[model samples]
Target chain A: MAANISEETLKVSYEQLSDLEKEFEENEVEIIRHQVALNKPLYEKREKILSELPGFWPLVLEQAPPDVDQYIQPSDSAVLLSSLKNLTVSHFEIDNGGKGDPRSIAIRLEFNENEYFEDAVLEKKLWHRRAKSGWTGLVSEPVPIRWKKPGKDLTQGLLDLVVKVWEEDKKRGPGAAPITKAKDYTPAQKELKKKIETVSMGGVSFFGWFGFRGFPISEEESRAATAKDRENRRLRAEGKAVPDDEDDEEDEDEDEDDDPYGLEIFPDGDELAIAISEDLWPSAIKYFTSAQETGDMSDIDFEDGMDEDDEDEEEEEEEAKGGKEPPAKKRKA
Target chain B: MAANISEETLKVSYEQLSDLEKEFEENEVEIIRHQVALNKPLYEKREKILSELPGFWPLVLEQAPPDVDQYIQPSDSAVLLSSLKNLTVSHFEIDNGGKGDPRSIAIRLEFNENEYFEDAVLEKKLWHRRAKSGWTGLVSEPVPIRWKKPGKDLTQGLLDLVVKVWEEDKKRGPGAAPITKAKDYTPAQKELKKKIETVSMGGVSFFGWFGFRGFPISEEESRAATAKDRENRRLRAEGKAVPDDEDDEEDEDEDEDDDPYGLEIFPDGDELAIAISEDLWPSAIKYFTSAQETGDMSDIDFEDGMDEDDEDEEEEEEEAKGGKEPPAKKRKA
Candidate 1:
């Protein structure tokens, strides 16, 4: 952003500027005065707006399903607060026109510290109605259901939009049952869109919010699904086909989309990893010893992934080797 | 903050309530549900308020004139963020209202790691319209001058609203010779009130903002005033006349009033102080040595208050005595 410097300037005497090393003299003062003239009242209005804020703004943001939007969670936002780049909590406040409907929040964000106020800040005063939810949200490109397919209910409309497209996907044989087989002929983007249409045909998608508290994906269930996705991804890459899972790869794909921008996760070798893990040996030994003494393994789950079978096998092996060897030593004793 | 428990009761089954051996399990769940019911709307509204807040609420509060009567500095406003409590720079935004009257801003604030959002945190909002210049201003209980002696203009109408009683303090005798004397007859509270009135009468009493930015009392100047107050108190108690300079005793009296709570200061003896000072000798020597080499003394201004007069005197005395005696004895060597 280039500064809008005015054509005319002012002068400063040497004595006046001496303390400040003749820096930003009266010329700056004049410029500032002109600038203030240009925009002083906004500063005044800013104070008024500040005073007008609802007291619960922070709480409103905090109460969002998983706290706030990624934009508000400075850690997750596209930009972080400067002054050495700290996180800026997304701040929001809802304006209810005397208990009226159509809820909307006035949102606030912090920009990169060096950015100008006009560029750095964002606020919307009007109360906005949030987008209606259906199967897989209508993102920003809100599909006009009536336009796409004339149906009474949004779900019916959306289904109408895609059901035929997907049912045809079932490529039925005459007098035989129908089945799904991904078409190679369709373009990748079209195929992908059709696939999404197929996945979202059944239930209402995006329950609580677009991404915050999803309807069908319970937190722990999501975790398990993620683990399955990771395993499936590994298996698929390895050419091990998992059957009947194609209809619901959407959850995994959506999960993958959550972390869209690939974080450059560099894997460090065991030189450092082993050194750190080895340093933990003394503590681990004491922990295992105590767990064995108390016969409690819940706290040691991560350290020892061994199940009862592994423990029993180890005991049997120890009996075969140590019991007989110790007997020979026992004769000497 | 008492919990509201309603008279109306609800019931549940034995199987449902049997978390314990016929204890309060059901009662707790019932009461909790009731409490949640009572408070859920408030919580919802709180979220709404949070969402409605001006983007720059915290910033505006940071700018308030400390008129809220809470003494929390930006650093000390209780709630500090924990990842750290490192002070982030304040952020602000101006609202122009498309260029309208009575401007405003939205401001934001940071909380300490553990503090909640409701703590007292506003300051610096006012572009304080300071009081115009005057000799002394009266606070509560403005005595009516007209009731005693009438002035052509108020001094009467001021007394009408209990405001202008202060504007007419200047009573000049026609052929008066200048005279000054501290009145001994007046009651102490009256005297104290008069003194306060005198201090506030000049150039916008609260130039900074109401209670936030007091006028003319630079932080250091206030400190000086407090010191002078302590000195004056000691002198007055001793019955020592400090000479008549009453008209401009803003330095001393104003200082005394600042610390209204009257902290019971008990001065510690110098013995412990000397012990602490003596222990620092080694570090001081090392510091000075390093400072001399690195030219780091520019950063330190506190330790070098002593002047050449004292050092020269010390050297001369040492030379006249120790040097002469040492030289006479050194002739043998």
Candidate 2:
């Protein structure tokens, strides 16, 4: 073992691995295509079966796997339990060739007549789009939940604020924009932000996730950033001058400091959606069945549990009582 | 949302969903087969590239993503850095058609001339087998490391005890035996257990993972259990008499109380192997490349950091400093 292992060797090896990784990614794309095709009938079958079982979706949410469950506030749970009629997850881009990502999904939640909202259906689309940093996952625009009354809003007004910001973002004409700075906010937006900050001191409601606009970078911007990153990495490997991402890092910190309502609502929204679509949706029947057998509907107190110091230990105890399992199922794309 | 949704409708819907889930699983299996084929040449290329770079595996281990890195002791790090020559992960069952699980992996570690062990290579094979609980994962019998001296043993003699116990298990005629009971332990076995308990107070070594025989249940037993569980669930759903698993749960607790050397060594061995094979192995180049540029060799202090109450906070700080990213990659199957 020598300390003199050349940087060139590592660079070459990394390049080779990157090429192999590309092949792996291509293989994944093919698998996603197949999965999209295969899931069509299963999803249809699921729809039929769920229709036969009233309160299926709501019950499933009550037993939501811990990751997604953490975001559900008491108010959100009440709304979902009372009104959520059907939940469907679909690969919306399946019909498109390679132009549209097959991993992109549409999550639709149908509601029966309820006091919470006027709309019968609330839908969110997540494009499996890449980020400037080369990481890729679900990206979406805010879908306003038409709350029937301010008192009935599960997000406690956070949803309205994010939706407003998103609508303002639409004026930028379909390109990636930097996260809105606090100083840049309109007076009304600032007032809404202040109100949301105070009201959502407990944390964002699960419904607020509908407003999640994953990494703000557009697809085109992401591609460019990815290319630039590659070039920089190559330079760094060669021990040549390479520009640092200090500016990007600073920007990220600034965005977090501002705590834009969308990001605040669900910083892990992309992953949450993935978990819901891939793990929770497919396994909803299991959760529903298990909850019914155990009579453990009272275990959905994630918001209260979040405030505890010994949350991990509390969760372990919950798991011991067969309350929930960590969402581990990842059936490909 | 009605409370009067019939149990029969729920049961029927569950059955349909289960059937749909099976289709999803079949699709997953197909994707895994394709991945296995696609990965073969890439792995071969990796082997070739690794040969050109000395100390690459050790360097990668130094930058091991947090989950795997947490198990590596300071002493283990010294041994690995000095002697670890090559690391290779392969799906051994790739050519076995449908008989063998394609997800089953063999992790091999080759050492150069070293003071720690006599063997040039240590290999552990994990069969992607199912447990009686219907959960499937990589399972293996212990692979003993031939340490040159007692002091050189990375597992602090825990491996030796497990190997003895495993040898004793071989005498039981190869059926699925319940976990070994403390009351049944031979005097020597009892003494060994005591010694291991005291010496391994710090926790199990990364090397200890080699002896991880997952779940301690045979594949035959698992299949039978799956069928029985299904039958029991149906019986329960029909409000008929169904045998409870309280006895099994008690047995599980009793087994844990005894702390069998194998289970004590690595309870999450199955998941660790999958993370290594699927996530770590593929991403080793990225880790190696980043580590070299950042010069962050000091960040691999997981074993020391484990004792602290602020371990999570410490990890966050480490991540902020570009120490390591949470292992998030899962290229499908």
Best by TM-score: 2
Cα lDDT tens digits, model 1, B108-181, are 22333232223232222211111212111111112222222333321112222222212221232323321222
Every candidate's DockQ is 0.01, 0.32
Q: Per-prediction TM-score, please? A: 0.14, 0.76
* Model 2, runs deviating above 4 Å: A1-5, A16-20, A95-99, A131-135, A169-200, A215-266, A289-327, A330-333, B1-6, B15-20, B95-99, B131-136, B171-200, B215-265, B289-327, B330-333
**Model 2 C-alpha RMSD to native:** 6.6
**What are the TM values for chain B, all candidates?**
0.17, 0.76
> In lDDT terms, how accurate is model 1?
0.25
Q: After TM-score superposition, what is the CA distance of residue B248 in candidate 1 from its true location, in Å? A: 40
Single-chain TM-score of chain A, each candidate: 0.18, 0.75
- Proportion of true contacts reproduced by candidate 2: 0.42
> For residues A1-333, could you state the per-residue lDDT of candidate 1 as single tens digits?
011112221011111112121121223223323332333343343223323322212212221111012123232221221311111111122121132221112223323333212234422222212111111110111111122223223233332333343344335433332222333223432443454455444533211011111122222343355356446545654757756665355433543233211110111111111111221211222222223322333554522365434543443343322111111001010
Model 2's alpha-carbon lDDT is 0.68
Output the lDDT of residue B4, model 1.
Answer: 15
- lDDT (Cα, tens digit) per residue for candidate 2, span A25-63: 656677768767766776787788778888787877766
lDDT of 2 at A17: 62
Candidate 2 docks with a DockQ of: 0.32
